[model samples]
Target chain A: MRIGCGAGFSADRLDPAVDLARDGALDALVFECVGERTLAFGHRDRRADPQAGYNTLLQTRLRAVWPLTAASGCRIVTNMGAANPMAAGRAAIAVARECGLRGQSVAVVLGDDVTSLIDADTPLPLSGCNVGDVGRDMIGANAYIGADAILPALETDAGLVIGGRLADPSMFLALLRHRFGWDAADWPLLGAGTLTGHLMECGAQITGGYFADPGHKDVPDLAFVGYPIAEVRADGTVTITKLPQAGGMVTTATVKEQLLYEVHDPARYLTPDVSADFSGVQLTDHGGDRVGLRGASGTTRPETLKVTVAFDGGLLAEAEVSYAGRGAADRARLAAEIASTRLQRVHGVTEDLRTDLIGVRSLHAHADHGLPVAETDVRLRVAGRFESRERAEAVLWEVESLLCSGPAGGGGFRGRITPSIVTHDAFLPRGDVPTRIEVLTA
Target chain B: MSQTQTLPLRAIAHARAGDKGNTSNISLWVNDPAHFAAVREQVTADAVKRHFGAQVQGTVTRHEVPHLHGLNFVLTAALDGGVNGSLNLDGHGKSWSFILLDMQVKVETGTL
Candidate 1:
């Protein structure tokens, strides 16, 4: 069986997905879109507008790929439903109808949202705080559902399978499991399938998009990098490759980098499906952008399903001003000091305020040990978090004041205030969250 | 002792960083198997923690992937509260890999 990745993230390119659906001879196209913060924002979007919770590009993506998938009989599986799968399913149906595929069916997998199961007394493992003490408006909670939730939808043989918080790897694993008719207790096969899903989940990462370094690791024609495709056998061995005409090269290096991406313990990668062990995984480079992989194993699945609990985290205010020429770094440093003093003394907004000189030492300032070097250009940035808009705007107010009140050569001032959300990890019993599938036809 | 020289990890290895909540994981892979031992010897969890200093809070653990000649360093509380709450421009610490790659390691003069 062959599976292709259409998107690695919510905003991944559409043209590559279009390329895959049309020419890749794919049996299934998976779009894994939801991230921790994306889901939190999804809840906020849904609260504002009932139909706005799904991926903002759902219609555009579906329209571009639906026609091709319809023609090729390649099923589309995705978590583009985000905070609202039912609504996203309806949106997909609309896209199908618009694309002239009137009989296309979309299966929506529900029950990942477990907000009703949580309460004020619920504990958050990472924050060491209970829901009541978080001191912010609770948005919602979503359990990371696995293959079981998605399997039924795929079994329906719907043209589209959609869900919210579907575990990234499980989407691909479900397809492989269904195709191979593998038993749920087959740990080794599940492990291999999960490995395939993880490798393909990031799309172009394994295909050389993020693996490029001009002098060191050169990737050809990265501008038009291709997404990845996985060929899985019944025994769970797989080979990862991409379209021939597409850009980017897939070698052992790219494969190894992606294998451990976002992975903590190589021996214990805990997904809802199984605790996949990638430590012993072997990679063979078969010239022409094809890399063969095997030896991934797994133990039992985690008893509890991980959930992301989100809260309205007030506002994040950021303001910046640039300085250049002979004393650029000095001027930017002075601007930062001035902004810091004003935010603290005048505005009383010192809690989370931070200042940095971009060109000199912004990102690594916390750990910088190198000697200071002269810089011709520098931008001073001041950022803070506030509970109220008034306080948040104070951050911008102080930085903008530096133009006239202090510093020389301060120009190109820009400021923004964004509503933010904070998330923490929680776990729910697998039995507590039962999934149901609903099929809709255009 | 035989003649030895120092080179930045980037000269012999490549890395990619990823984040989960406030923790950041950087996987460093040596271009050649010959350099893997030199890298694994110097790039320990404690050395990495010191290399990062105050930038990372909490403990750092190094997981060895000998078969791939790679070392996975997991730094907890490394992202300054991670993507959601970090005020740093690179909240996800995606560039942290470069920071790790910038570390200088000792190698035999002719190892390259």
Candidate 2:
């Protein structure tokens, strides 16, 4: 099953590709541990830093990918963007048994930690209350699998692979369905290898940001943007390389905007297993750096079962203060609506407690769910809860100690607002969702 | 609690001819292409061909895989009326399970 995929992008820097699983030269690594590259929620001062400090994004991605996947030998599937993947897969098998590596084989793919099984109380078909009061608030909750269930746990010898909240193309389709044992009625070659793991799961947008195609070449200097692979060919056809003399520029508009990211329709392309058709995804020109995606079609696999629940729904806070010159972004949205009407007259919110401004809808993408704000700064995200978590952590620790003496300036409240809550647990759908097929390897 | 009591598959999801006609570009569950990539990343195919591309007027086709309905849409006609939105077949909401997560999986269990 020869599977491999790597990355450690931050948390105290040191991603020499997690030393390819400590020298075996590759097998597993996908540690984001938190998430980054979005800033500009008015540059800085959403009460001092709304996010960007989950301890430098997941402690430098689990101290450089759980000690190179517990000291290497390859076999990884990471969602590193954690919301607790079983305590991040038991801190990645306690750093592969504290890097002892002796008898390795980790497995923690808890079907994307369903934020406490849908709720208002728990009777949900389509949000009708009773998922025991739902709010599993998510700006992110990674958990993706489907390289045919991680190449048979990396061809039986498993090493280090812990996942919760997958879908970075299920870590590149569990390394091409564990090195091509590929089946499940081969829906258009597993929907063209699940759109080639959704076109190399976002690495340099298929190698040239925003699908760079204005006559192509020139942008190769993208300060070192590479990372997109796919040789695939159990007959589903693929070849989108990057690395070897890498840099940037895999063109065809970077595999059509990385197969149009959160994609909607370019011909059915869904993954987990076929429903991919990017209208016969055709990108021809395969010479120098290769780029071929002839005819892709997919569909098949529906027995209903896709749950992600996170519970405990309570205790949340918010704050922010920043507004640079010239009406500094509308006076920082009138000081975040005067500190949410002064925390709605001191913690009184109820329309079913939901707040926004998570880095401006995660960087310009939430207008309907709110956050169309424009200015120098705005992190007025306010949350309230009461069925008690100690009265929602004492009104979210007094909404983070009223960011520098409550609302609008205490000099635009700078640094110190860390208050992330998590004790939430939920993962519904415990039956009948198995198309049933087997094989393994990361 | 919902052990073995929800199975009535009906599917529809169209959006071809370069898209955008007022609306109509469905997909809720046409036998799983990853659940149509999670329902076209949540009801999109350009918002289902612009919201239902005038009930798929010209009629677009392609969907023949062994229907197992978690859902799949194009309502324009109401039940299966063709141009979209109509539901004629049978079954209307409430019964599906799609949670195919493969996080950091590389299982071989032995022979490495």
Candidate 3:
């Protein structure tokens, strides 16, 4: 049984695999919803645009593909609802139960809220060593729940499931592997599938974007991006590939680049299961467009769990303006100073008015950061708290007006700093606890 | 004459085979000189010459570091650029995997 998982996002862009590969051959699919703009990455001083978080473009596209998936007969799951997975699940279950899928179970995995589970006196996980204390103020702590937890839901024969962040990719993987009864110790095979899941989890990693050959000349009309495909075997070996006729090159090099993409430790590539030593991975070109991946041995699984949460961090503000034309660099530097001084004089305080000549390193570093501001994007993001939401909402209105008043006409307002509770937390489920798995269908 | 190394399917599928030029890096143990001779004979220089093709410069040289308890070889460059090599990833070429396989040839314990 082929299992797959990927993050939720706008479908029209690149990374067509999750949307494209909804056929019957795929046993199950899990879509993870994370709010992001077109080019989500390191703090962009100027983001082109950002869509509303609650409004569901990611889900709309995800749901749009459902008819195709149902036609092909693939079970699905997701956490695209953000703060509303329960509501989203209810809506989806309504859709599933519509056509004789009532008993067709779809688990709604919650329990991400663990803010009060531990205690104020309880040691946080990342604290001092000698105390043996994990004392952490998890103002925001969600369950670092793993797919093993979702097995019960899938076992219930649920056709649809919704959940919070469970390491995202493992959503599709756990359900499919468990459905197929794939062995956990089957490291090589499991690793192959897991690797494929990892590549597809982010949608565009395996596509021509991150993994494309740098020196290769002719590209397969990148205007049309193709999604990746994994030929997962019963034995656990999965050969990842794209459409046979896709435009991008799916060589070992592209795969290698993706494998190396943002990995912290090559040897200790941690996950829910055992830790696989990525340092020892090998890629072979076994003819055709296929690149065979082999030998991904891992160590014992971890004792604790990891999680992500958001909470109220109060108000944070930022502002920047490009210093373009001649002496643009000096002009930007002066503008930032002026803005800082103006704010300080007005409110008896200086908000963080960061200035940049784009491509330049950073102001903290004395040297010319990187870009030589013939024209640079100047951005400022400031956050703060409000006695009331109305007061907080007023800041954006003020900044938009400041766009015209700032010394640099280029200085403009961008995105909103919505009042959000920045949550943060992680858990360490004891290894000995049989990791209870119960599947019930109604 | 390319030597054929009996490896678990994954070794090749993932391109884990060490590629020092053209010679392959392998994970095997030899308790005696005869075994080395056997390995040397079985995985001959001619094999290296045959696999990489003519673009490479010369005979492959084997390097066995006692520290590693493994064997690594460097072969000539065969398919240098164009269709394959040019793709740059993070400013590095995805052209080859010579060093990658060199590291995977781990001689497990209990085997002399």
Judge candidate 3 at residue A310 and give its lDDT.
32
Distance from true location, Cα of A64 in model 3, Å: 1.7
lDDT of 2 by residue, A1-442 (tens): 2223344222323433443345424444444222312111111222254432122243344456555655554455665524444444444455555555546656655544333234355454443454445454432222233454545445555555554345455566556656666666767777776776667654455666433323423466665655555566777678775555555667553455345444445556545545677654667757566788767777784333344332322333333344343445444445455555544566554423333343343221211322244544444444443444444443444445555555444244332222232222222332422212122221
Model 3 regions more than 4 Å off:
A4-24, A34-59, A81-84, A97-104, A127-139, A184-193, A211-219, A245-247, A320-323, A350-353, A359-415, A420-425, A431-442, B1-112
Ranking, lDDT, top scorer first:
1, 3, 2
RMSD of each predicted structure: 1.0, 23.3, 14.0
Residue-wise C-alpha lDDT for candidate 3, range B3-41, written one tens digit per residue: 434432123222222221122332232323323443444
DockQ of each: 0.80, 0.01, 0.02
Chain B TM-score in each of the candidates: 0.97, 0.22, 0.36
Which ranges of candidate 2 are over 4 A from the true structure?
A1-3, A6-194, A197-263, A266-294, A297-442, B1-112
lDDT, candidate 1, A1-442, per-residue tens: 9999999999899999999999999999999999988898899999999988999999999989999998999999999999999999999998888889988899999999999999999888778988898888889999999999999999886999999999999999999988999899888889999999999998999999888888999999999999999999998999999999999989999999999999999999999999999988999999999999999999899999999999998899999999989999888888888888877888777577788888888887766646566687898889988888988898898889888987887999999999899988888899999999999999
lDDT of 3 by residue, A257-354 (tens): 45544343445656675565555666777756577666555566566765433323344333334434555555555555555455456544432333
Task: Report the CAPRI category for model 1.
Answer: high
Q: Report lDDT (Cα) of residue A99, candidate 2.
A: 54
* Interface DockQ of candidate 2: 0.01
Interface RMSD of each: 1.0, 17.3, 17.5
